[model samples]
Target: MLVSLAIATANQPPNIVFVLADDLGYNDVSYHGSEIQTPNLDKLAIEGVRLENYYVQQVCSPTRSQLLSGRYQIHTGLQHSYIGVAQPNCLPTEIPILPQWLKNVGYATHMVGKWHLGFYKKACLPQNRGFDSFFGYHSGSEDYYTHFRGGYGVSFDDRDHWLGYDFWDNDVPFWSAISNYSVFVFNDRVNQVIDKHNKSKPLFLYLPFQSVHSPLQVPKQYQEPYKNITNNNRRIYAGMTSCMDEAIGNVVEKLKTADLWNNTVFVFSTDNGGQILEGGNNWPLRGWKASYWEGGLRGVGFVHSDLLPSDVRGTINKQLIHVSDWLPTLVNGVAGYPLNYTNLDGFNMWDIINSNKTSPRKELLHNIDPWPYQPKDFNTNMTSAIRVGDWKLLTGTPGANNGQWIAPPGSGITPHLPLTIPGQNVWLFNITADPYEEMELSEKYPTVVKTLLAKLDTYYKDSVPVRYPDDSDQANPALHNGTWAPWE
Candidate 1:
């Protein structure tokens, strides 16, 4: 009985805190060589294991779905696009999610920040989808101050022109705007949750911050630090990032004050590559958000905890991890056992991270049919990609329809600098040998291409059919007619 008690005590799980940044660039954080100052992020990198090759979907909603479900977005009906404001589509209710899995093992799961997956109905909201509590907006983007989604296809005077305010406190509307910046507001709420949480149960806090996205807004104090940046947009962008960094610092300090810092498993990552038009810079990478290039899919990520092996701490991990892997990895880490969940596209990377070894994930089905939601008048085809070992194969043009804009106004940056467009159909590259995709070796390595193509074909066949939410005739009349009706 004593031996069994010891084993059970040893298997107790550590608290988890996941911080997800929205649309942050690969080089945006100072640790990754950006000019912007992200001292808190730098500290996290210095004290944790930095993931060098973390990948996500080229867009938002798909990545979020995969992060929560441990399955490919295509398998979950979130293929290639985000749910527009008031759209009826959302993550299928049948699928199990991360919070539910964690809660099963006595963890209190909470989320604060963006929930862009879906919100057309209460069933699609985060509270109903397993999260015990949620405080944030539900749309793709909203005014930081007004908390309103500017409507589509209508004038400001029109009743349908503006979506209702989006800020929410777990199903109740958060109408009063705090004087503090949105980032700071989120930080305060996180601290409150941490302080008030029941100590008997392990905590799982998911903070998906909406910093450095669109509508570049920041407090004057944050902007003061970036006075040296000559460009207006870049300066504001820098300030926004700084504000988020400071907020993170405050939260970390709170954890320390609550004596939960050392016992917590902390993870920081971005949803996808940065949006170039929003002053996001993915320097030395090929494309921006919405593109299948390295810039769009790759993101910045790191993990820290006392649970991590001492030798692996503060080291760069060259593991090919995907967004879907987090659910299984965290679950396995907390459970102190292998879940081996069925039908999961993600691998439990706990062993790799703990041992400071190469990830067992040898191949990845990165994306498929990425642009299925294109308007009917536009030409759309199956655009997909797969990565095996160091080689990558891309079929169809990944971002042909994406507009050409590298930076916001006053940044003085041309779009797609030193541009070298690939051929229309198939393109192949050894990403390990050519990080920037400078060389094309499809013709030279036909056998390699053939193997990759076969694997890609298998993945495509296994994937569920792509569903276009925008094309659904069953959309609420308000959404179909370009109006915003939260009550609907």
Candidate 2:
């Protein structure tokens, strides 16, 4: 009996599996009352702790940078926007990332799908950033079937466009003739990783699925269920999301088969909120992907594990969690400590999560940057937002506009336009009372507005300058050549 107990206890440190959905909205999942069916995600929420107020950056790479470093994106040299494929901008190598921390603790780290952080040089690739294995695309978005960047004036029919193929297996170009939808292909790679994982050692699997992003693509079988949805863009978006849901189901089944289900802590979340242009609906919430509104910053998230106390499971956690929190949470979960690292913007909410207690976090600095990467013609500085308790303040322009729901490609929909303020030039709201941000309360409570603005000013002073402006012409060569090379 003692020998058997030791054998079982050998695998005590739970494996960590983080699943990130690209551009999934608050209302996109079935659990959130969207028409789209996400039974797998719903099941996870039912079996785990659902975070109601989980927040991320308003865009992709910013959130990703914070997620990995546990530092604010501004500190990570990714202050304003996503990294362009050919742009020299990248997550600074000096900062310690989550994978590197986990690796130090004897965990085998593997990343599968969508490494949008940087690819200008091999030094910035995922494998160089402490991931032992990496399999996926390097660009922000790619064709689901062809595995190439779209809308760069590069036709699939053109031979030159083949150079734009972005799929890779650990820095090596994956030019295999295998033609399958990217969602399924990524899932297949994940399954393989799970199957081959060393049972004795802990596994840290970061699976960032390229689902529900632009260039909406899904297999016919996945699309069949959403045929009743009349709108073409929405129908396609639903199908893409459903495909991701099924992929999640497959991963869960794999965990069960491997007997790693109970000993694994699984987290599911989106990088940011939905993009309105890509048929994403964060309805009733103020703004879309690039805006600082709750619709763009607040994301759907849940954590499930048998290790969680029974009382905490199947409960809604109203904690004010940030994307940066994951690094510390997982590091603490695995009983790992980082050396020579003290400052982190994220707080470890494991105690609050497991005990069903209120979050220790009370304030969130949403963002303090100009509009991220818009067309030169429509470029305008976006207002910054800060949330403290129930009070929220917006500086500059809020950029709320009513426009085309499903925006055409390259339409340049400027979401944030300057709101006319009588004297203060700021918008204030009690988010708890008015989640939609319909009513401004700056005039009603001048003191509260003043306090929040002071706090924003402090953050602004410490914030790092933007590393690369979004509208630079440096990426023009790659856009014209239909490929990105480090030497270019």
Candidate 3:
């Protein structure tokens, strides 16, 4: 049931604009700790609430899966990155998506960015998946210049035709403009969508920008300002980040111009952690995007909605929340959709968002496939983990773990393959005190390790592993290891 307020201004539900950035780190934004200039995002933090304790899965697919399905990746058979377009492709069609629910409640839904989840045919497109309008690439990253194929100048044009099946808008073939500025193009299209529907009913815009991702190409104008950064990798990355920041500013200005700032809900977040090696700097934290450490899974979260309470209009909440919570939260506040389905891994933070109080999740869950595509010992190189209080326990080394396990090539089919070097030892850390995993206290507290291990074992036994049990799973076979059993 929806809560009611005495002030009955209008029956119109508030608009929601969700903006997602790729490879943006937790502290990379200007408001967090970085020196990057992001006035619009910083202003949003000051006027609304900034969430510091919110978490997501290791890589892109899982976080996206959780965001759309309101369930963990494994629960939806998307345990690994869905590389090629195949069966059990992107997000399953049987399950309902976020936009579909919003459409059911009469809100106008639009997406003007990445839709990498799945798009088998016309029926599996954005139009059929609940969004009324969409204008972006269907696959993963694309060249900013050509928008043809890969992230860098590397092109796969020889294999597939780029112009034939180019852009899409509502299941129809839309215009495709190949330029040296993909980011600017995406932002402009998003503005167009908002302008066309600003006068209509409540609006929902999903903008998944691909600014800070790979290929390391930045517009020369944006790249020139960061020449003083010294580091070549970071210089190009800084350019991308600043350009994205400016693009965000543009969108916010448009919202304010239409007088929709106060009546709309704006959310800014990243799909996963940063890629430190490829121009991302997640300083003061241990690991990068694929690790189970704080650095690997933690990203920025800011929510600015008209429904916020006056006292907490410009507050900060450090409560633990996950990606799965967004669906239910939006459904409750803006979409007014039914929550009949079960097994959603996240809890609604409606009260906490309004009051900035404590949350109820005792422990947040974190898990990934064991042995990425390779087999290794300890299974830490592959599998799920749990975060209780300030401690995080994994099957392998947090720093060495990049969310994927590595084995010798062609070693999976045969058991006689040689083993690889052990990256880091299994252990636990006090995240509150030592945010990095530099100090290990596993030997000091044997009992704590035992208890956490037992809990992790219980969780694995109950979970449905998205992939099969190889040498990694065999090394640590929990109850439901490789078993297709739903949580009871």
Candidate 4:
């Protein structure tokens, strides 16, 4: 359907730039009522299509894998936590991925920022994983300034001991990557890629920022504006967010200068909901990152492009969009490739984003974690969440912040979403009506819960086992000459 594709300048496929923020809260942006200033993100959402009902995984690697693979975590055996530096597992290599698909259609694929998918082997690195060039870290989290990733001192220790530089130019380690904050390092590199890009070809830039994650550190100048913030984490987070906002604005300016703005489609999304304890607040939505609550999975997302029809531009879209849908959306929709050649959990969401059409996605399997005994889990899988139409069912222990709606300090908000529940597990919510997950309604909707449970079971039947492995001493920086590089 070339008619549906953007008639971008030069008649080439639209340049797609996907920017993923780490652990960004639903309400952290100032536009969402938080005190954090984010003019660039706000501008994109306000000027483009603001995704009010976006969904992503509750953690980093799961969401990244889903986005790149265009499949649910269950299909890829990444249903567990993030791919820690020492973990022997990764986002399997045999399966076709997003960048590879893009490159197949003549798009130059590039990746900058965090590569948390896996790096135990060179095959898992972004460059080998279809990227034309890669400039980022391999670990999930690291010092934004020092660029040192903390892992076990010894491979078997499992304690924070080894701290090594994590900057890379491609496959080789590049330690002298300018002694400065990562926001600047990455931003400059992204602009450089754009500056030196062949304008005739389409560009696919996957920019996963290291900002607003953890080890909260930002320049004093970025933090100076938040002097009124009493909370230490919040203040530092505010600075990191501000720096990211500025970086986005600068990137937008670079696109314009490079004459790529007219033909570019910019997509911004968070890997997951905010981490409450880490200066993030998903207010009014129950729980935080790693929980089944709306706060944890509902993401902040938007798309900006000249391709969008004028009437639909600057509008709020409540369509159901999932992270897994990016694969088909980009390949089949934006790139105008047919979908018959592929089976993907991600739908071609171009209609929902550009044409203001209803989303084809109605049912979603949030996850099906590892569980040996699954007899009582609604006759399905345990430690999971599923959405069928308006109903969302969550079962098993949801881990930290269970059923807690923690308002940020000085927020002065007293949540009324009843905290009481039948048990720690088995929660059903009509997310359409109760986005905040105020009331537990499993007892009220027995049949709906039963159907959702059955669906989870069916999905679990198709899912491969979780591939998260324990940290090995081989990942230790000590073993790699004080670096967190591949050892497999």
Q: What local distance difference test score does each model get?
A: 0.76, 0.76, 0.68, 0.84
Q: lDDT per residue, candidate 3, 174-282, as tens digits?
A: 4465664768888888778877884557788888887788768888788787666766777788788989888988988898887777677788888887887667766
Q: What is the lDDT of candidate 2?
A: 0.76
Query: Top lDDT: which candidate number?
Result: 4
Question: What is the C-alpha lDDT profile of model 1 across 15-99, one tens digit per residue?
Answer: 8899999999887999988889999999988888999988988878888889999998658866766777646677887888888
Q: Write the per-residue lDDT of candidate 4 for residues 9-116, one digit (tens) a residue.
A: 545789999999999999789889888889888988899999998899999999999999999988898887777777887889998889998898899999999989
- Among these predictions, the greatest TM-score belongs to 4
Give the range where candidate 2 is weakest over 10 consecutive residues by summed lDDT.
402-411
Q: When superposed on Cα atoms, how far off is each prediction in RMSD?
A: 4.3, 5.7, 9.7, 2.0
Q: Candidate 1: where are CA atoms >4 Å away?
A: 1-11, 153-160, 178-180, 337-340, 370-381, 400-423, 471-488
Model 2 agreement with the true structure over 1-488: per-residue lDDT tens digits = 22332254573456889999999988789988788899999999888999987899888998888999999865775766578665666788888899999887778899998888876667778899999899987776778887866435332234243346678888566766147888778888888998899987888999999898988878878779877777677788988999999999999999999888877889998988788767788865777787777788888899998777778899999878898888887886343454356788887777778776677789988877643542222111445788899988877554435211222222344444325445454778898888777777888998997898778777766766668733334343345344443432
TM-score of 3: 0.83
Query: Of 1 and 3, which scores higher on TM-score?
Result: 1
Q: Stretches of candidate 3 above 4 Å error?
A: 1-9, 82-88, 150-166, 172-175, 198-200, 371-381, 397-425, 467-488
Q: Clashes in model 1: which pairs?
A: none
Q: Which stretches of candidate 2 lie over 4 Å from their true place?
A: 1-11, 150-163, 334-340, 370-382, 400-424, 469-485
What is the number of residue pairs that collide in model 1? Answer: 0
| TM-score sort, best first | 4, 1, 2, 3
